[model samples]
Target: MHRTLLWLLATAALAGSAGPPARTAMPAPPPAVGEAARTGGRPWPVPGTPVVVRTWNPPATPYGPGHRGVDLAAPPGTEIRAVAAGRVTFAGPVAGTGVLTITLDGSGSPPLRTTYEPVRALVRVGERVAAGQLVATVETEEAAPAHCKEEGCLHWGLKRGEVYLNPLALVRGGHARLLPVWGV
Candidate 1:
């Protein structure tokens, strides 16, 4: 008796159904906060709009192979500027190449550090630098090995402790946002 009643209910439910449920459109979420939003508008380290020879390519694992920074095409002796106000944490050579690092002010815990390599240091460690201030000049080929084979390039990097971030985000105010496909 219970089996017969169950069968009747199942038959009635299926008979009332037309087909599978239709999918409804949902609103796209807002863009995530980026470095530019957190640090305000930071300027590009290189003068003018330098051509990007290489973009940031993060590693899959901590020890994985990846380009930790972006490479901007600049000629030898091109002036380099500070992207944000901060103190110079390191200004010296690393493996025969001149390197300069600045710890950004008010960038939160651990703070954000910006680094430029193959640059002759103009600011010393512990020196407070303001945004857009000249910090260093790109090293000549004779001073250091060429980073880019075709032309001299400045390797710019940004990190919060051990995590590497896209440096371009600092200049652009954030990453590019994609629009919804349905025009929402």
Candidate 2:
């Protein structure tokens, strides 16, 4: 009877000593990209509102032929600014053309990356740039192949992972909203 009593006490003590059950820690989700856009208003990369020489034309397939980005008509030597705050991931020449890419901060997993080409980079790679901050200047005709032929243009691109997205959507306040219709 004493042994049974002692075993019961020991079991009770062990159970009482043990604290609440352990919980597995879950990683916090990343901030939404739209929230970042709201905090950082959409700003034109070029001075004023430059004409869009070519609009974004997404391809049917990843390897399909299509314009991956938009071409903004800006003369050579024209200053180019960042459309959003991000860290410069690439700032150098690619395919004989000066290219600059910025990976947006707090834009979720595999963050959105913005690309600008045919521009002489004023900011180097790994640099943190604010929205509307000057990052480069339009590359001269002699420096690289003009995307818009004789007239120079800055090709702006946005990508999340390998999928290309419309950069103008950023400028146009992202997704379109629907209006309520009244019954007549």
Candidate 3:
């Protein structure tokens, strides 16, 4: 009886010590090449500028093991523009990193919410901004860790209700579909 009791206590102690699961948010799968066309929207958040996708994993659930957004290879202090007309809803720090959210207007039921992270907000909350209008600037390593090696990156995300939608769909005019290079 004593041995069984000890085993139970050891198991309980180990389980309690385990704590919460570590967050392993993987990058979302590549978006469809060209799904449905965007109803209507502006250009890339950073226009006329070349950008590389650093990370593109969107979490599979509202709180799941997936990247909830895409990280673009952007230099620190790069200007971030609004993808569409909307009013700034949130501009604040999240876990020591700055985050800015804009609730898009006329985006349909629930309204799509766009988020830019590791940014320094240039626009104020509740301020109306037009497509292509500057809203924030990517922060430098001095402010936060350079997420993209020494270059830094901008984490952009889009969500409707609690569902995380690919923000690339907005930039590419639709979903970025995967096309086979050679037919088998």
Candidate 4:
């Protein structure tokens, strides 16, 4: 009983050092449907089918512990497309997860880049792909057991320089709705 009490105290001390988790009241509304096209943006990286996002939390700082991108709910082997016309800059594994990066043309002063991860890349580095073109496929348990078997989702990310942007902002057509998480 004494040892257990000590362990609980130590755990509480470590938890206190970690501080409270960051929370946002809620994000502002997203653009209406077709608003992106009206604004001259390209279609979603994965189109046609409705995208179900499992997670959409970006880190407040570089290398922070928060989720750096949105995880889209997709089955294994689903085709992953390019969100915009760009050249494939990377198509390889990074720290175990398969990552694909595309540098957008005429996107901004510093240029925008998009990244998809835990995918079985089909395109080669330096390959110029058009908007909505297939670049990779979601990984299956046979391909990436760690991520695919755990949860079949595509982690879609966007960045300009070192600043991460919300990838969903590029595709969300309606207002943002916060999904509640209930615990037992």
Best TM-score goes to which candidate?
Answer: 2
Full candidate order by lDDT, most accurate first: 1, 2, 3, 4
lDDT of each: 0.71, 0.71, 0.66, 0.64
State the displacement of the C-alpha of residue 172, model 4, in Å, after optimal TM-score superposition.
Answer: 2.7
User: lDDT (0-100) at residue 80 of candidate 1?
Assistant: 89
TM-score per candidate, chains pooled: 0.70, 0.71, 0.68, 0.65
Error of 2 at 94 (Å): 0.6
- lDDT for position 32 in model 1: 24
Candidate 1 per-residue lDDT, tens place, 1-87, comes to: 443344334433332322332222212211222332355555678766567676677677999987777788777888988888999
Candidate 4, pairs of clashing residues: none
Candidate 1 vs candidate 3, lDDT winner: 1
lDDT of 1 at 30: 18
lDDT of 2 by residue, 1-184 (tens): 4433443343233322222222222122113334435655567777764677776666779999777877787788989888888999999988788999999887656677899988999998899998878899998876544457677778889887897876765554422333578994
Residue 66 of model 1, lDDT score: 71
Clashing pairs in 2: none
Residue ranges of candidate 3 with Cα displaced over 4 Å: 1-41, 142-147, 174-184
Model 3: per-residue lDDT, tens digit, 81-118? 88778999999998888999999987766778999988
RMSD of each: 18.3, 21.4, 15.2, 14.4
> Which stretches of candidate 1 lie above 4 Å from their native place?
1-40, 142-147, 174-184
Better of 3 and 4 by TM-score: 3
Score residue 164 of candidate 1 by CA lDDT: 77
Q: What is the lDDT of residue 100 in candidate 3?
A: 94
